[model samples]
Target: MNIELHPRLAADCHRLGQVPEGLVLLQRNASLPWFLLVPATPREQLHELDPELRHAVVERWNRLAAWVARRFDCTRVNVAAIGNVVPQLHLHVVGRRHDDPLWPGVPWGQTLPARAYSEATLASFQTELASALDLTPAPR
Candidate 1:
């Protein structure tokens, strides 16, 4: 099945590529080492997926979080799928450090501007993330 990404995601994230299970992994533009795991299926909630697909998504989420923790050396990793505004079924895996701008609070409601990556930095990050994920670039 062909899976189309949500336009909002495309706008706000840099596509790191797709995993074998069809999760189109994305790196958010923010500087928090945040990534989004989006199932290609056009669903608004995880419960709507078939058992096998749902399990795969959860497994991928867990793996991504662990990888982020080790790679970023962050104090903690936060994972969530709150679709209040976008209403799309996507999981966010974020690496959090105690000294971060919103240290004791969640990253979602912060008012600070997102940190932007330079073109070179973004390219380097994409390379590292794709290598870690062992994923091939998906057709944009």
Candidate 2:
């Protein structure tokens, strides 16, 4: 299936790899470990999906959440599917810490300047994540 990511998402993230149900993307911001899972389906809401597909997606979400929490040593992991901006069926898995820039606030609409990931850092992370999740790396 040819899954096209929303322009906004494509602009802001690094294509990591594909899982059984969807693509995984790493948000460009290095300050926080934010990941996105865009399921390959036309359905916009999680509840709209049939049981099997929904279960597959949720399983991926749980795996990504656990990985993010452990990798970032996060105080908390925020997972949501607020598609008001992009209207795509993408799940956000953000790692948060008490000392993080957004602290008590949500990452949405925040003006915190994105700390771009260096080439080595991004590549290393992509490799590690792909290995950890058994993902097929996105094409170069």
Poorly placed runs, candidate 1 (over 4 Å): 23-28, 138-140
Span of ten consecutive residues with least summed lDDT in model 2: 131-140
Candidate 1 residue lDDT tens string, 90-120: 8999899988777768988567556776767
User: Best by lDDT, which number?
Assistant: 2
Which residue pairs in candidate 1 have backbone atoms (N, alpha carbon, C) closer than 3 angstroms, thus clashing? none
Scored by CA lDDT, what does every candidate get?
0.76, 0.89
Q: What is the lDDT of residue 58 in candidate 1?
A: 91
Q: Pairing residues by index, what is the TM-score of model 2? A: 0.94
Model 2: residues with Cα > 4 Å off, grouped in runs: none
Tell me the tens digit of each residue's lDDT in model 2 across 44-82.
999999999999999989999999899899999999999
